[model samples]
Target: MLTPVLIVLGSYFIGGVPVAYLTGWLLRGVDIRRYGSGNVGASNVWQSISRAAVVPVGLAEIGQGLLGIVIAKAVDQGLAVQVLAGLAALAGHNWSPFLRLTGGRGVGHAIGFLLILSWPGLGAFVGLSLLGVALRAIPQFVGLGIAVAPLAALAKGQSLEIVAGSAGMAALIIAKRLLGNRLALPPGADPRRVLLNRLLYDRDTHEREAWVRRGQDE
Candidate 1:
């Protein structure tokens, strides 16, 4: 019991390392959130810092998720305990205490957790992701693909723990897509338009360039 609890707590802290923040500060001497869609994730790192920064930030975050799963597995805990550790890691990445409860969208972290549990889950993820790209790269559908991985896990007879953990990651991704960084609309900007852009375009309709943060092909 104590071991599981410690795993959860330790994983949470590991998940909250603020990789993007440090990466940006070290490379450009600026708060990543201040520019490039104001996101504290790999996407923003690519925008404000360098194209190369994205991979490292993503790897660090994914490693955080994997760290939690490894700890759980090391304790020889059952599926339930392992799932809890994974979720704790995701929550920490999504709402990192070090980043004032602001963090990445959890896409990489989700990938890490699912990949560790079941590679087939990633097959669902990739197939859907490629389909979305083939259809002209619609942001909404691409993001919706996240939900498919968990369902695939469930259909494949994975344990409840695996299914729930995948589902949790899907939820975090969808939620992030819907409600991105703190709402800082320019005066007179229609909330409805902003919501549409966030949900569909993955950027502020008004300030697409800043949101793209050098990541998009713009």
Candidate 2:
């Protein structure tokens, strides 16, 4: 029991490392959150700093995720324990202890977890996302594909642990997207409408090109 607990906690700390924020500071001397999407994430790293910065930041987040599951699998002998560890690592990115309990959106971290836990789920996500893109849906709908993959796994009758973990991850990622970066509504916009915009267009209602202006994009 103690060993598993330690593994989960350790993975959380590992996931809490703010690679994107630190990377932006190191390379551009500005807080990554202060520019572009005001997000301490790899995407903002690419938009605000040189595109090359995303490589290391992406590697760091993904590697941390893989490291967490690898440690779990090494310490345990069952899929359940490994799944728990993967969720812990993912939660670390969603609510990182290192950054005052705030963290990135967790897609990159999810990539890492999915790689270690279920490649098929990852493939499902990619395949569905590509299909959505081909349908001319917005980019944010592609994000919905993450949820679709796990639900598809459940439909396929995969093991309980794997299916639950995948679905839980999908829920967390979409929840963050729904929350956007703001805690309060920006007066005049309906809450439901704003959330819908975020879920689809990833911007406020009809505010195209807001991303380029910085501070306006979620």
Candidate 3:
């Protein structure tokens, strides 16, 4: 029990190392938070720095999870250790340390977790990722794949660890796409874009819906 708690906290601290922030600052002398997607994740690091920087950024994401497993295994190796490690990895990705306590959306880190914790879940993740890419190519279905993945996992009778991890991953992905509802041209914002962002990013979905209703009534 104590081991699991430590794994979660330690993984978060490790995850919070903010490799992307350091890389962006060293190469470009710019905070990644100020540019592109305003995220201290690998994608923003890649955007702020050179394209080649993604290599290290990607490694950092994977390393966080690897570190978690190492810590967990030092105490014990079982399903609980893996689950706790995955959760820690996600927390670290979202709330990193070196960059004023901020970070990315955790997909890279989540992928690392799945690879170590459950190969079958990793397989499902890969399939969903491919389908997501294809569905998003149409632009309209940009985030539908995220919602679809959990349903697929539920149908498969996935283990609780995999299901919870998948749900967490799905939530992060959907929330991320929602926050990035930027407009290339701004005569007027696209309603579909606005609605999708609202639906996906709304942490309190019912509340957001109620707010929308009030505005519509007014």
Clash counts per candidate, in order, are 1, 0, 2
In candidate 3, how many Å is residue 149 off? 4.9
The number of the candidate with the highest TM-score is 1
The residue ranges of model 3 lying beyond 4 angstroms of the native Cα positions read 128-157, 176-218
Q: All predictions: root-mean-square deviation over Cα?
A: 3.0, 2.9, 8.5
Per-residue lDDT of candidate 1, residues 1-218 (tens digit): 54888988888888878888899889878777777776777867876778888898888888887888887888797777777777788778778899888877776777778778967688888787778778866465657667788888988998887888888878877677667767577568788887778777767674566556543333
Q: Kindly give the stretch of ten consecutive residues in candidate 2 with the minimal lDDT sum.
A: 209-218
**In model 1, what lDDT does residue 217 have?**
34
Candidate 3 differs from the real structure by a C-alpha RMSD in angstroms, to one decimal, of: 8.5
**Each model's C-alpha lDDT?**
0.77, 0.74, 0.62
| Higher-lDDT candidate of 1 and 3 | 1
Query: Which regions of candidate 1 are displaced past 4 Å?
Result: 133-138, 213-218
What is the Cα-based TM-score of model 2?
A: 0.86
- The residue-by-residue lDDT of candidate 2 on 1-218, one tens digit each, is 44877877888888878888788778767766656655567767877776887888888888877786797777665787777777777788877787776667777788887888777788887787778778866455568767776876777777888898898888877776777555455568898898887677655454755553564343
Candidate whose lDDT is highest: 1
lDDT of 2 at 11: 81
